[model samples]
Target: MHIQLVRHATLRVAYKGRTLLVDPMLSLAGELPATVNTPNQRPNPGVELPMPAEEVLGGVDAILITHTHTDHLDEAAVKQLPKHLPIFCQPPDREKLQNHGFEQVIVVESEYVWEGIQLYRTGGRHGTGEIGEKMGPVSGFVLQAEGEPTLYLAGDTIWCEEVEHALKSHRPDVIVPFAGAAHFLVGDPITMTKEDIVQLAQAAPGSQVFVAHMEVWNHCLLSRDELREHLTNNHLSERVQVPQDGEKIEYKR
Candidate 1:
């Protein structure tokens, strides 16, 4: 199995016989407006896309969207993706995607098998307090295929009971965690923080964790350097990966 960690939460996963692009935000840097109050609130995606949109979208058999957040599915992606391609997303975003002129949009409520892979829905908590409730429904996914490693893609979420349940139940071999610690001016962090990363590392021993949703947006508080340093200091650096845009990592089962 191979996975490419594209910018932010966007990535490509290659399993037994399918190539699935997950949460593609293809807009060029500075194209989108600021999402929150920040001194560097010039625009979203503070950095440019590492590769061309076509290159990133190449060989994609399907698309998997955890939610309809702009960072996950931006304007450029919604406009550029082929209308005929299959889009697998959460139940709430089904009608939204359909209204966007997509021909094939499938909602994953619990577990669903598409082609040769098994996709299981895992719950998530985007934040705490009233802010979390306002974030709406988001989901994580556990993907399993014959002769491939089990992968758990943890969408935009902080450390919570839902996450603990996912680790205890699925016990995936690979976990793609959204660890950006993103937040707004008046709310708590909506994503994982350093302590959360440490807790996750401790909870899921031997499971490879890949950090996502960092270093691009203004709202995200954590940086890749700080995350790596903390992990290294804790002697847990090798267990997690901070992959760059377009960087591909292959896992052997």
Candidate 2:
């Protein structure tokens, strides 16, 4: 499988003979406003896309949306993506995508199969307390295909019971966790922190962990350098990979 980090949580994954784009935020840097109630109110997407948006999306076959958050699925994405292409998302987002003129919106409630790939939906908590509640429903996915390694895409979530359960149940060979320690002015981080990544590496000792969702937005406080340093200090540098924007990594069974 080939996975390319397109910036922040967006990924271009080529697996099982299909190219799936995950969480596409296609706007140019600073096109969007800053996230409210957080430090560093600079315009969102602090950096530009490693390549042009069209080039990044050139060969994609489908889209997998973990949630409908603007940072994950933005206005540019809605305008740019082909309406006829299949879009797989959680239940709550089905109508929203349809409303946006998406033609084929598939809701992966628990498990779904499409063109030989198995997609299993899993739960997640975007945050805690009222913020988490306000963040609303979110999901992750476990993807499996013949002759390929199992992959777990842990969506926007912190270290929670649901995430631990997904790790235990799927035992994925490749794990991608959205990490940035993204938080607001008055709450714990909504996304995985460096400490959470360490815990995840320990739990899934055999799985290769790749970190994403860092250094793109103002709310995401954790930088790639900081995360790499933390991993080295914790003796997990070999197990966890912090990929730069547009960097692609290949995995084999």
Stretches of candidate 2 off by over 4 Å are none
Model 2 lDDT, full chain set: 0.95
TM-score of 2: 0.99
| lDDT to native, each model | 0.89, 0.95
lDDT of 1 by residue, 100-185 (tens): 99999988989999888899999999999999999999999999988999999989889999999999999989999998888888
Candidate 2: tens digits of C-alpha lDDT, residues 23-91: 999889999999999988999889999999898789889999999999999999999999999999999
- Whole-model alpha-carbon lDDT for candidate 1: 0.89
RMSD (CA, angstroms), candidate 2: 0.6
Q: Any residue pairs clashing in model 1, and if so which?
A: none
Residue pairs clashing, model 2? none
